[model samples]
Target: MLPLLVLVTLASIAALYVRGDLNPILCDGPCGPQYVTPPEGLATQSPDPDEAAAVGSGPIDGRELAAAVAGPLRSEALGGRTSLVAVDARDGKVLVDEGDGAQIPASTTKLLTAVAVLDAWGPDARFTTSVVRDGGRLVLVGGGDPYLTDAKSKGSSVERADLATLAAATAKKAGRGPVTLGYDVSLFEGPEVSPAWEDGYVGSVVAPVSPLWIDRGRVGAGRSTDPAADAARRFAELLRARGVEVTGEPTETRASGATIATVRSAPLSRIVEQFLADSDNEVAEVLLRQAALKAGQPGSFAGGAKVVSQVLSEAGVDTAGLVINDGSGLSRKNRISARTLAEAMAEVSSTPRLGSILSGLPVGGFSGTLENRYVRSGQARGLVRAKTGTLTGVHALSGLVTLSGGRPVAFALMSDDTKDVNPFVTQAALDRVVAAMADCACGA
Candidate 1:
């Protein structure tokens, strides 16, 4: 062995090298190490085609894909007629098409409503709910803001226009004494409940469509009988709590005087996202009417339907043979083809104004309406994002899905005649079909 001191010095040098603090080859003072730089040509080497192919692999056989998904779609569990259409979101190539013609769309109709509203009012548009002075009475004017709330306004994204905020603003101008309180729902005209809708839809799936309502006219998940009246009562209560005494019960009237306090809603884009993600019927209906108002038509179910069709047609979507009875698709008479839904989704992907609609769709096995769905199949768990529609006999799923090659595909599947079959079974069948699309490497 060498001297102990030499050995210790050698050990220290080795330790320094190990710790990356010493360079053996450079002994000069403050030595700068030289690194071998890769050549420009090597740095920019073209990716191997084979490796690219492997990374972007997808289904190569369309026949095999059809065979894989056909059985579940044809299963008796899905009652009545079944219509489906899938297209490459990038190229609009038809991946799957079955049973043409219109079918009951259910809540998937909101997708159309969303596009129409976004077309009529750009994403940045905002709705305003205001309090104006009508003589000595304070009249709350509805601006067709669906997301308005009773809770204190948090910010732009959370709470739009809260009663507390509106009341506080109104209190400052109206002085302390008792004032007559009323609300103007004239912003929306026609029947509160759609004649085409089933009676059970009220107080269950949706409330009466109104220009102004708190929490989407919901006491919770359940709906209030007369949402506008309920909202007016709540507004009065808030005004009373704010030291502004209300003389009597609040009633509906038109505001034809100076404006006092105004509160704007969250931007239209955010409302569309929440409506689509949560499948909010009230929001959908309100947006439908709002779209009609924007289009210079009466804010009614018929007016909204006409405006929606007109707007979609203007957007280059084929509205031929399309019948929209209501904005929310609560009406069983509502008919839409899978091709139309897929086309609309494709339009959403291509159109800059409507692009945000895709992000609002529920991701399979992850968020929103589809959280509990796609649980049985891992294939579509994170890859598929869709809107689910369910009624008694109607089961529909439509949205976008990323394939094996990371290509996005838009699909719409509807089964409207399965009243006899179990709903869970129908949903499972639909899930399997969408999951198959995600797993497919067709034409890879």
Candidate 2:
């Protein structure tokens, strides 16, 4: 018990300090210091391949479930554009569709990003950032790891694929003194910001979509302007501190040679867990490109979007009305249907290779982006696992929930008309709707 308590504490501190998600605007104050009862049983093992089906495999009364959820969605705060869906995952039975069908998903779009990356790379894969030799120069290579931390960073294995680690090994191998440093950021291509994204989103909303970054692209209150360059420069500083001389500023390059030292990100499963729990925009963007590269496509906004669509098709998750202008869904041009979002949750719950996706969704009142949420939800606290989304007009929730009857259900609730409403009001309305589902005995 103490182990779990200590673990949760460390994770929370790291999240608060490191992820820089504490921005007053990005983190709704409701994502609390207000902790609730933790989950009944937090399983670390993999679920059965057919668990979603096994749990939800029964005659589902869709009408009963729909009737139960109707009143909550009627809340004026949600606006008229609300979209909702609840699917009995196993049988593909939808229990509700009580509002307009599709809307902007905001960070909930990370769900699609999660599915695409897991599908392409498999769960155990890790991203590697290496220090490689190029004649007298040492080139720091970015393998698209957004969690790569700089030296002197406080990190666990999952957080600190530290540049300091790479620097030590490089210095030892190079045998003393000076080396010109360059960075290879050719891994990702196209405009750093998606064409559909706002000009101001680059530093504030996310770091430039460079394959390399340190501290998850976080700078003071925002993100680094040139993440790749910033990372290279940080690496040089680490090397210099280690008594190795770095000649000149790190320059960009394409001619990287024999690897000097390599540091790897945590496996895809762990990476997926952190990014989803935190609603990390930077990690989502990088994963999009990584998946694109695996599929022989450009590792750019368009390419990642293309690969995401292809992988969803392969996983049998519907992508209808899914328009992805960028991997992170920061772009208002992105559009996804409630049906598609719910089905993606269903696939994550049901598929074997895709299993890690569910484990990563933030627990309703305990961790990640959800820490301050669900305070008003009764038994739903700590029981719900979902990815939350927030944009000016956009508010969304999508993931799995278990009914009072223990029937596991996949659901999505989304809206774009809430810009006129207080963000907290709309978010609370969505939570009430989900909490009602948790407490319902709809099968009877």
Candidate 3:
């Protein structure tokens, strides 16, 4: 009898899967939500190179959109913490709903951090991981440069070749005798993984998020029981064994405003672009700290949060239902609502700094976190640009979606404190919502 019951349940689940009720729908067809049809003036493809950009940047009505998105979102199984906000970046429209404010941002907090950093430090700024000749000892001082890698690309955490090259360059520059090489990581003041960051989360490579490292924040390629700092030590030691001589202890440095050798990143704008597109936590954290520093505060989580609050207040965005634990949104304690995010999105979109934020967004059906998402949904495929967030019980996508009439719509949807709901499901729901917007001729 028990076996039969199990079979029945399995059969029902299968039936739901077949009926498109069990999983979130992605593409437009009989399987997914209806395709959103552009109203009139909106371009279905990329804007023509010769086209003049439109600017009016009216305020977005986030409250209305929030109501629509939240009604269905919260009705689902979230982990009692959820946030969603959508802002029509082009026109400064807010379409959002109110939910838990201080929910953990996870990687989503990276967006805020990235933008603030760009604003604080011009895009051309480069972080320096210096190779200094301190008497008989050669020290590789870390300037918190996140992109010192052997690979000629962003997000490639492996910097063996690059480190090797730098070491070789240093050796060649020295031109004689063995010089002791020391790895200095004194720029950052604490552990790579924050006390607020979960240990298990920090342990993984995906979160391979570290305090500071050269190669775009990649951990050494292996499994280890050591903490993040330990990994840094091992990496440094590996460099040493690789023919880079060392005499002094391999330790984290605490030097500031000191220059040895500088390795510039691919512009702050580029970093932010990749960050939003890839949803990189390490880049986000660095950017956040940089922002704090820019805002005349310590470049730390707490400092960044304070800066964010100040920015929001100055920008006249309502922070009634907002709590930021960390800029990366990795914290489960970070809370935000669709309304707040929408407001922010709208304002940022209208500002001259829109490029930093918009350029970073993952193009729907193309790159970044949304690379594999919304591929089949024709209306949302190339038409939607957004950021995606996911945690154990949370799934969110927020950004801009351009529709007909050259009108852009912003939307954020988040689900937290839920049971057994995957990101795919939430993505399906979001796709449907975007499709609905696409098909609507609201402005037309």
From the highest TM-score down, the ranking of the candidates is: 2, 1, 3
Highest lDDT model number: 1
Tell me how many residue pairs clash in candidate 2: 4
TM-score of each: 0.84, 0.85, 0.73
Per-residue lDDT over 1-444 for candidate 2, one digit per residue giving the tens place of the 0 to 100 score = 999999999999767744444433333221222232223342211234465445454566778777777899889999879888888877777778664655788888889988888888999898899888877898888888778887644334357478888888888887665789999998999988787987788788788888888888899999888888888888889899888888899999985479979988878877888788777888888998998999899999899889888887876766777899877779888998998888888888888778877877887776677777864446477557888888898899999877655677899999898878999889888888888887776653
Error of 2 at 434 (Å): 1.2
Error of 3 at 77 (Å): 6.6
- What tens-digit string does per-residue lDDT give for candidate 3 at 62-173? 5444444444554444445555555566655445444455454456566556656766776666565556666655556655555555434322322212454555455445
lDDT of 1 by residue, 294-327 (tens): 9999999988999988877876666667998788
C-alpha lDDT of all candidate models, in order? 0.80, 0.80, 0.58
Candidate 2 ranges with C-alpha deviation above 4 Å = 1-57, 152-157, 376-379
Q: Single out the weakest 10-residue window by summed lDDT for candidate 1.
A: 36-45
TM-score of model 2 vs. true structure: 0.85
| For model 2, the run of ten residues with the poorest summed lDDT | 28-37
